[model samples]
Target: MAILWKIDPAHSEIQFKVKHLMITTVTGYFRTFNLEVETETEDFHTAKRIEFTADIDSIDTNNDQRDTHLKSADFFDSANHDQLRFVGGKYESHGDEAKLHGDLTIRGITKPITLDVEFMGTVVDPYGQYKAGFTVKGKIKRKEFNLTWDAVTEAGSVVVSDDVRLMAEVQLIKQG
Candidate 1:
């Protein structure tokens, strides 16, 4: 029998970046996120599920004012939408690369998002726990999901890019 796994929150990271002022960039990370990975199947070719949920208020950009702004109504509206989630989908591994199909919800809008997943392989820890690593990267247009708030600069460049870059490192634990 194969062993499935749960996420080790302490070892996982969730982050995102977006163009700021059209010349600079802004990056932020969520200190809190949860994940569950199904790894019991020896046949990795088959559908394996990845479920994730992130706390919106945990966003950290190292700038208090900016962080507060991000949680305001102009952005995530954290008070109204306290979380961002991606729910179950299949995954296929080819060589070191994989593809994940799931629903990404932000600002209360749920949309289908496909992430380019790279399997960093798996190993057993010194403590004898099985672990898997993955690096995920994807891009989404804020406007497409109704996150259309923006400001134009004097040169006509928007303050925030329509496209946002999301990346994360997931650490999975194995079920005995």
Candidate 2:
């Protein structure tokens, strides 16, 4: 029988990094997100179904002005599309590394994305909960998702880079 697992929000985080001013990097994170996985065994390599969703409005870049801009129509347009989702399509495992292929939907646009996953092993927590950890990394082009707003500095440097890197440190608790 397949066992269901839920993401432990307190132990998991979804973060992203992007180049700004064509010279510096800016990091941000989504404070609210959820991940669900269904597997036949304790081994995550056997995962059959994986789904994730993140609240766009929970984006925090530290700078209030930048956070507000990110939530505006120029970027995520949180008012119209308040959430981003991912549905797993395939799971390929090679030793301790894996690739998770899925369809990522942002601003209503669905695109194929593959995330590199590192199995961080599993353990029983002090409270007796079965837990698994993973490190996921991926990249996507903002323009491909209709996040085309941009500006050029007087010196010709771009305000933001087109590529965005996604990083996640996730902990999943096995459910009875």
Using TM-score as the measure, the top candidate is 2
Give me candidate 1's TM-score against the actual structure: 0.91
Looking at candidate 2, what is the lDDT of residue 109?
96
lDDT of 1 at 161: 90
Question: Model 2 clash tally?
Answer: 0
- For residues 72-158, what per-residue lDDT tens digits would candidate 2 score against the true structure? 999999999999999997899998899999999999999999999999999999999999999999999989999999999999999
Write model 1 residue lDDT over 40-94, tens digit each, in one string.
4733455466678889899999999988988888888899999988986867667
Ten residues in sequence with the least summed lDDT for candidate 1: 38-47
| Local distance difference test, each candidate | 0.83, 0.95
TM-score of each: 0.91, 0.98
